[model samples]
Target: MVERLRGDWPALEHVLVIGEPSWDEFITTPWEDVRDPAVLPALRPDPNDVTLLIFTSGTTGEPKGVMHTHNTMVAANDPLPERLGTTPDSVFHMASTLAHLTGFLYGARLNVQNGATCVLQDVWDPVEFVDLVERHGITCTSAATPFLHDILRVPDLAERDLSSLTRFCCMGAPIPSAVVRQARERLPGLAVLGGWGQTEEGLVTLGIPGDPEDKIVETDGHPWPNMEVRVVDREGEVVPPRTEGALQVRGPFLFVGYAERLELTRELMVPADDGRGDWFDTGDLAHLDEDGYLRITGRTKDVIIRGGENVPVAYVENVLYEHPAVEAVAVVAVPDPRLQERACACVVLKPGASGFEFAEMQAHLAEKGVAKQYWPERLEVLDELPRTPSGKIQKFQLRAQVVDGPAG
Candidate 1:
């Protein structure tokens, strides 16, 4: 990251990087040669101009910078503020990283467009977070589901007057039905919404305000105005309402391609029937209800998200399997505020393997260039794992029995 930042200094008129850890690295360029430009509101670009360069979450490999134009970005944000009932009076707070599209749009752009005040904080500090809402009159906050879960766990949750927050939302991290009910009761005016999309695809789906708890918790809401979304099978054939298929979206908020990675971009965005539509495969297995509500079941990739960073799951699992103690293993996401999802490994130990503790497995993983970031906090060693008739590991069932424990 430091090397890339240093190499790109000449091209970057201005650069800002923020992380929790203090960095020893330094960059000093003479002001005379520095190319910093004045901050402005409006930007004029060519028809196919790139307004922002965003990188993918690096679920597969190194993150790729995906270029997006003003039209594409505006198309994504246009209906949101109004649809969400966020006006000039609304003050937005973002719990996620500024690097994310939703954070950039909700935290920065929406505030600019609506002339609403944006309160900025370095981390997702629930204590400071509650105070900020009270201090700034914040009416809207953007947060991944895990953040919401943590906020609910705060010791003084009921004591704090969080009357300012009208809505709390994020995508991918789902809010369970009971949790949604708890939020509605605890924060009466708060709308707990589930958004659906990825970095490659901009805002595609949303669970609207006043939606039924069953729909809100179980499924992603219907497509927004002018946004086209469909569920298709392996052969790209559109599937029936209740059938499981790969989710595809066709809309204005779509990306043309990933910068410097044409082949990858090609794989994501595919041609459609009308020749007027561009469909991006979401790589998520899901089924839509009769009402067009989309529910995500499993991810196609083996990306083990420990916090927000994508840790390859199969890669880590492979490393753990090398340890003699393990009979079978499953690594799934458990929520944490600091890291969006922390990896938790559940293992069925070999019958006679001794001195093969969880610590030993972690040490083995660290020795390999496996990136200790993928190591699990809550390691569960069981007698055996429950499996289906087909001999496939049912992770969701395991998750219910094991994964969703107290967040670290």
Candidate 2:
């Protein structure tokens, strides 16, 4: 993996390899060098200068390097610790890769900002997570929703002491209400908060402490301080409350731009009309309730149109997650000769579960009161859903598998 990474970027200068005995072609640093503490001076850099070059998850296409200035990075971390109740005494845990925004911003940066203790895990294991919670008194965590789901499925969960955990901020993807309910039942002391953001914009909305369960499960969350979100029509006009439209964000937490993609960045930025700064098109379909809570329905490209009727893919997937047999689900648009497009639900069943049938799927949707038009016409059970390294579902890959053949 290290060799592949090196090959991707050929601008060679110096390579530092730790823990290896020796690499003849590179500088082999000893483990002692990494472990030993050294006195270092704090060097202040320009806040407006770019400091972070993270990449998008690229669920739909090729990944792009997202540029972030020091000002944006600092601003992104400022409101998080307060909202999450993180303190100097709190112990944080992070299992996601630090390269991703969730891990880098919330796991590493937020812990530093709060001056709290953090336990980093290179790999995700639910059994290990429970043990760490007991050993380290881990009080808080911010990760993808699937991490929370896996934690709920861990065997010997009832025997573990997880009282130290309080806040679990689930981001990267929509939180299934079923998974949240399971967490509530299993970890009564833990608060499962759903959030929405991307590499382009650091956590713009998050559920706060003491929020009602409806807000915890149904809506993503309220906007963070200095972050503004609005739903606009295709013409860029603000839509009324509870109306689904493209989501836009204007905030200090927004990234500077995609590295070397200035024209693409400008194309997504909507010029300011009300004296406020320009709004960045989020490429998400969502609706805001009158209370200002954001509920993301689906990605604009992920929405399935059937017989001129739109199917909310995320909504249907959430309902399917309520099924006991379903471990993970992704609803993608399948080509249809007559309707132009149809919804096909690709699911991964829980271990040792009996086979699921199309009738059973439709029955469950009916029981959930989902509109008939929104019901997925077909169901495909796979061993597992394709996911990015950060656990976001690769729906584009799923679509290719469902429509054409298995993705290479």
List the candidates' TM-scores in order. 0.67, 0.90
> Candidate 1, overall lDDT?
0.71
For model 2, how does the per-residue alpha-carbon lDDT over 1-408 read when each residue is reduced to its tens digit?
667698778886566565554454345555445654442223447789899999899887788899999899889989876788778999988998999998998678877887888899888998999989999999989888889988998888988999999999999899999898899899999999999998999898999989988999899999999999999998889999999999999989998899999999999999997987899998999999989999999998898889898898888999999999999999998898999998888999999999899999999999999989999888899999889999999888888888887521
* C-alpha lDDT of candidate 2 relative to the true structure: 0.89
Worst 10 residues of 1 by lDDT: 20-29
Number of colliding residue pairs in each model = 4, 0
Assess the local accuracy of residue 112 in candidate 1 as a C-alpha lDDT between 0 and 100: 84
lDDT of each: 0.71, 0.89
| Top model number, lDDT | 2
Q: Which parts of model 2 are misplaced by more than 4 Å?
A: 1-44, 406-408
Q: Write the per-residue lDDT of candidate 1 for residues 5-108, one digit (tens) a residue.
A: 87767665544454422221224444334544442224435656888888766443456787888878778878887668888778888766678776777777
